[model samples]
Target: MLAVPLLGLINQYLGFLAMIAAIVLVWKDSPWQKGAKVAATIAAMALLGAVLPDPPEEGAAGVARKDRKAAAARTLTSPSPSAAQDDPSPTTEPRPEAADYRGMRLDEARDKAEAAGFGTSDHNASDDDKNIWMRSNWTVCFQKSSWTGSETKTIDFGAVQTGAPCPSTDGGAIPWPTMPELTWKTWKTARNEVVALGVVPTEHLRADTAYLNDTLPDEGKYDNWRVCATDPLEGADVTINTWVTLELTHPDNGCPDPSQSKEDRVDLPDRDDDGDPDYHDPFPGDRNRNSVFPNGLPDSSGNSSGGDGSDGDSWNCPRTRWC
Candidate 1:
């Protein structure tokens, strides 16, 4: 009729073959009877099935473009609840108020705990594993902290170097300086009790005939020498450069008996039994006839110059002992 709804708006199978060629040309030509050509071919196939256009549904236009791109990606990644209450959420800060940075000074208690917001950390409160390089020379001695927040808080501390003295509690350790009873004392009172316990004394002399004048023990004859066995012996703790040693001997040739054995503690004086002892026998009575202590025997200050008179000669050696 109108070419079968204008060929079904351009092709629904050419409007179903133009509505079957317009009902075979109105029933074989000018139809006007046969029930008026079956009511004009059923009103031209219901007006060409109401103007064509129906072949879609298989993937419905790709599910309507994936539901309009998932509603514009949820409206550009959802936001609005008043823009999520005007955006905020990052936080942290708090910390600050906690005191007692012990006797201060670890770089002014880490610059007063980083000006109160807090952070620092430290440790070695002096078991002397030393190393705090120069944080104002050290001091703090104990301090903790926790209220937790200043971007992760911190505090800790326990230091010690500044003239020492701190650990009796809060993270302990420091103390040191103990090793006292320096044997039978006397190398000038065990070098003034190892310089009043600041440590590092070092004497030695264990009698190789008091170094037959290779000198070095006369702090003005340090009370005729004594101390018997030390090197960390008596009590033991030390630190300020540690060392200690002492060992020496001469209280008229004594000390050496806690079950002897420093080569059986020799006090010298073999008077020619020739096992060589009058300071190594330069004829110490050649076989015991009558040598009232000759040549090599005088030194612990009875002084026949085995040195200290400055170079005694006659091969009794000691011109600083042969150089």
Candidate 2:
């Protein structure tokens, strides 16, 4: 009981009552009775303090605590009638001017931004389809907004989840190859198909490549693992080497059905005259130029073998002019 003398910090009244009871019960005792009576006197003095006009309490340890509490009460319970109008606690905290949403996942971040009671806007964090919000697997990697959270915001989310920043603005959309059924196809073979479709083979595929010269036991040199799945599933308009997810697995999963005609529905012909044909060229619709801009001339044997003039010569290749 002596060890916990300060336990009544939570309620001084209860402490005083306990001290009084102890004094009465030990009234006839010797040393204990004397100590109880002394404690009872202190408790009674404390009770008197709660009712009387409080003093500018002294700085001694006990007096200081009482003074601090009394001052706090006085500050809150003004003698003037205006205490009812004075608020003790602040109602709200200052919100951020522009919430830093970078690295934040979209589902939760969107609600946070909206709840700020500000005008809001959302944009594809990445033009790359894989970074879509509804997919519930993307995050905000970039954002633009006014000084206030209450203004229009333009945000974009993307590959940051893959531990990279926003998409590179370095390249533009090109004519993409029809997405081949990549599932169960050897990565080496699938890689070739991507290249043939006019993809740079390096950007997207390079990132996924894992050289397991030591293919899993019994898996031959040819067993460099097959692609379990391909993103931009078959025929989705894709940038040649944009972010494509090649979900790969062991070759034992099975090989691609080579039986599907390599020619079936393969739009290999150049409907347009600019060297890159419909399948490999972005502007297969335009007859005079190959891309969004001109100068995309036809080439042969990996060499630029077209006319130097402004108009393309669809007529003049000496060898097989493979676009």
Candidate 3:
């Protein structure tokens, strides 16, 4: 069997080339001696072919060797999830919780507070401008201190829209809560802190005209209030509970109006250059300044008119009171 297979292999090579050479020699009518020379060359190749291995019989040991090599190759190259399953420890750690108000509008503060376990007991917005005031309550469970009363923590938030002048008018929609200028003012019993986030406008006003005209004598033109502190106060381990009052104020002197009114009168030039009616109240009866009542007095519309406008709902603690 080996001799037959080796002869076939030799014929596939030397015999094929010799046949072509013989055909060429016959076509040229070469001498018969040239054909004998080609035959001799083919026989010499056949003798050398006897050293080569024979083709395997059906399912023979040679065939089994090839099959084993293929199987070993596949085993070496294939992927296995066994190592991954054996690992009990995770490859990656759990991620941290993200901020709740990372990029939302300041007007959404109420919704965020609600989601964070605060109840919206009172909500009001001033018509004169874009100021919104909200009073919310949250239940308290102190670890050590007795519940003489709940502590009141005020989180005053204000938002304003600033952008290129609108082409169509309608005062260009106030972009509240979206691309809004956000300011967070916090009051703890005695200390107050204000923080500004995002792009602030150049013409934003920080002080009411009254305060600017009265307290700051050297003011040329002021717009928007910057946060007084470099860092935000940490809200941790806080006890001694009572209702906290949050009041948004003019960026200038940080004082809440007695009635919680935010109106500011500004003088504008008359159209015809007449001096008689040169000055007018830019924002008259602004609700932002007047929404909070003094000592919880009700207005004509049956709304609280007290200085704080918080009424009995305010948790008046030993150190702080909400107004």
Q: What is the lDDT of candidate 1?
A: 0.66
lDDT by residue (tens digit), candidate 1, 102-125: 887888888888887777878777
Candidate with best lDDT: 1
Please provide TM-scores, in order, for all candidate models, with all chains considered together: 0.35, 0.23, 0.17
lDDT of 2 at 2: 29
What TM-score does prediction 2 earn? 0.23
- Candidate 2 at 48: error in angstroms? 94
Candidate 2 accuracy as lDDT: 0.50
In the order shown, what is each candidate's alpha-carbon RMSD?
13.8, 25.5, 25.3
TM-score preference between candidates 1 and 3, better one: 1
TM-score, cand. 3: 0.17
lDDT: worst 10-residue window of model 1 = 205-214
lDDT of 3 by residue, 1-323 (tens): 23333444666555445445545655466565876766655654554455445766867977898999999998888746885477656567543332343123444554665565543322111122533332222111101111123533223332222221111223233222121212333222122221122222323223333321222213433224322221112332121221222223335344433343334433233343222122231222333222122123344565543334454344232355333
Instruction: Tell me which of candidates 1 and 2 scores higher on TM-score.
Output: 1
Candidate 3 yields a Cα-based lDDT of 0.35
Which segments of model 2 are wrong by more than 4 Å? 1-95, 115-119, 125-137, 147-165, 168-323
How should the candidates be ordered by lDDT, best one leading?
A: 1, 2, 3
Which portions of model 1 miss their true places by more than 4 Å? 9-45, 50-75, 78-138, 141-219, 223-226, 230-235, 239-248, 251-256, 259-323
